[model samples]
Target: MIPSVILLEKGASTIHADVGEILFHEDSMALFYYQVLNGRVRLSNFLSDGREVLHNVICANEGFGEVAILDNGLNTVTAIADSSCTLLKISSKKFFEIMHEYGHLHHVISQKIARELHFKLFMIKLIYNRSPEEILSNLIHKLNESKRLVCQECNRLMLTRQQLANMTGLRVETIIRTMKQMEKDDKLNIVRGKVFVPADGID
Candidate 1:
């Protein structure tokens, strides 16, 4: 993520979003580059059947909605506030200027996009005919590997069981059942109804 000083110097503004607020809809023109200063954002697509497919969760210090700006295209996914959030945003023109002025930012952005691609590819491979446990384990592993875990110290997951179901195209019940079994098998832990993975990650 670009430094706040840089973004503010380039005319960035801070915005507060309430939980469940829609920042932008799919196919909307990508007018700004957004970075979370606090809280979380969900990036997802709604299917024709009205089912949501989660693309990614943007946590504090992470940027979202950049691909569209970089590609000069419309947003491919809708961005919603997963929790009350403070975000910094700069117009696309100013963002481009910042990127041009700071060449190293390009590398940072490229790495983020590559991680997203890797996650998508991994999900596509695991979501088909994979066991619930396998899917969940891999998903957790990938999230941890990508530094997306909400609590890095305890390796707490960012998504709820329902969100996991949405991301993996599984049922909520299945996600819960599988996670319970995973805990029993020592693959993960559920304490007081909240889930946590190993700090070192699942095997």
Candidate 2:
């Protein structure tokens, strides 16, 4: 994320968005830079077969739409609110101005952009080459790193089967079957509709 000056610039402002609202559309010009103040946002796109693919699930204190703005091009994916969200919306002009004024902030932002791209590419390769259980485990482990989907033990993951399916590109039924098998094998547990994977079992 960028500095406070970038967030508090002349044209910058905050907005509250409801869940399921479309913040922006894919292929549209990137007019603003958005940083999530709270709640979750999803950047996604549809595949050729009409299936939805989640490119990223962004949480609090994270920024999106920067790549498009930096390139002065269209958005590569649509951003939608996954929960009621508070966001800092800054005009691209002010955003660029502040970034240019702050060299260190620019370096941090560049590093974050590279990290995000690396994670996305890693997930893409995993989806094609790994087993469903392995895929689910890895996704859970990654989310836990941010503590966005963790529980008291830090070993428990609070996710529904459908959510897991959407993230892993598996059918809901497939996720359920695989999870049940994993449960029987003591690899994980499904209690009260939440998926739980022990920290050491996430290989």
Clashes of 2: 0
lDDT for model 1: 0.90
For each candidate, what is the lDDT? Answer: 0.90, 0.81
Task: For candidate 2, give the lDDT.
Answer: 0.81
| Model 2 spans with C-alpha error above 4 angstroms | 48-50, 145-159, 199-201
lDDT by residue (1-203, candidate 1, tens digit) is 89999999999999999999999999999999999999999999999999999878889999987899989999999999999999999999999999899999999999989988988898899899569888888888877876775578777887898899889999999998898889988989898889999767888
User: Model 2 over residues 1-203: C-alpha lDDT tens digits?
Assistant: 76545587656798999999999999999999998899989888878897777777777888998999999999999899999999989989988887887778788889988888787886887799558878876777777665665665756775556666767789999988988888888878777767777766555
